[model samples]
Target: MWVADYLSLLITCQAMSQSDMEGVEQCFLDISVDQVLHYDGVPAVEPWATMYIDAIHDKRFGDAIWARYQIFGDVVDGLIDDGRLTVLESIEEDAVGYKKNAPEAFDEAVAFYKSVTNSADGHPEVIEIIMRIDKEDVSNRYFPEGG
Candidate 1:
């Protein structure tokens, strides 16, 4: 799945040693800007984006995170360009620390979810994706291990 693909990239990014600048650059190259920009995966995969952003802020990834951040921006811009407006808006809103306003954020997410599900653009595959994501055990859902 796309989430697994993303997580694999992130895990590879995080595991790179400081001396592996060449490998780091290659990793950056491997993460296609087009793919990130066109990402149409379910909302459950959103945390992987956060994980990438968090890696940027972390000291462990060193300066490679800056390049990752640039790619992330490209992805965001792509989302905007592709008319994934709600996804972009949700990302912006979620950045405000959802834990501090869990109830409100969750309600908003649910409302947003309903809107998406009910939209004319909605499809059976999208609903299936949502149902698959929703059915995962909470532990695996939230803290999935990279394979």
Candidate 2:
């Protein structure tokens, strides 16, 4: 089980850009080890979290990435629940399928992020972190090779 966890973490790190790795690292540092190991909803100390922290702190990764990993799901779910599917759809259009246009999609995403940040219960800090992410950081993850 440990090996499997490590391997998955390795794969995730390998796939991430240097900045994203740093963000992951910061997240680990900000969160306690106990939180990672025993969070109620999710095991925060899983492979992805561990690999990110190790890569940035131990491996000396880049520093451009913002810490957004922790709140990613919450942001997405909030958007969906709020019926802001246009934001998600725009991102998908840019990231994949027939309308794969990074600039436009990124612009829309940014706008949506800004809106979220300004609204009540927006979790400004989390939105701020996510706002720092750019199209290049996520495009490859969402879109298949040559897609």
Candidate 3:
């Protein structure tokens, strides 16, 4: 699963008052730190905006994931254009500072998340938002950890 997707799961569980955060955290996920260390004001996820707005119009309780979407939904949508999707292969070369040095930590985090989701059979649909966000390496700092 992607970083934003993982975060959304945590936020969703937190908002729902579910204990999934423990499962997520105990899995040793690390996208949160990678997001903090790599932000550069790029855009974010588009599908999450659509899903969040749709949820807002519905009668559901305030999902922590949705609340996070509320915070960054616009930015997420802006990342996409009418006819294309941005694809981030990985962190850029000459990453300048912290991003240059954080690969091992980030990879460790990603591995844990993979293990957790694999153990679960598969990641849930809610995590797709984070996947979308992470795929672009867009600015995902708005969705905080432990939210």
lDDT tens digits, residues 1-147, model 1?
A: 999999987876775554333222231222432233335331213444544334433422322222343334444543432444433233333322232345454344334444543223322333333334333333322311221
Residue 124 of candidate 1: its Cα lDDT? 34
Error of 2 at 109 (Å): 29
Model 2 CA lDDT for position 62 = 19
Q: How close is candidate 2 to the true structure, as a TM-score?
A: 0.23
Clashing pairs in 2: 36-45
Residue pairs with backbone overlap in model 3: 4-130, 5-130
Instruction: Evaluate all candidate structures by whole-model CA lDDT and list the values in order.
Output: 0.37, 0.39, 0.32
**Which whole-number lDDT from 0 to 100 does residue 110 have in model 3?**
40
By lDDT, rank the candidates, best first: 2, 1, 3
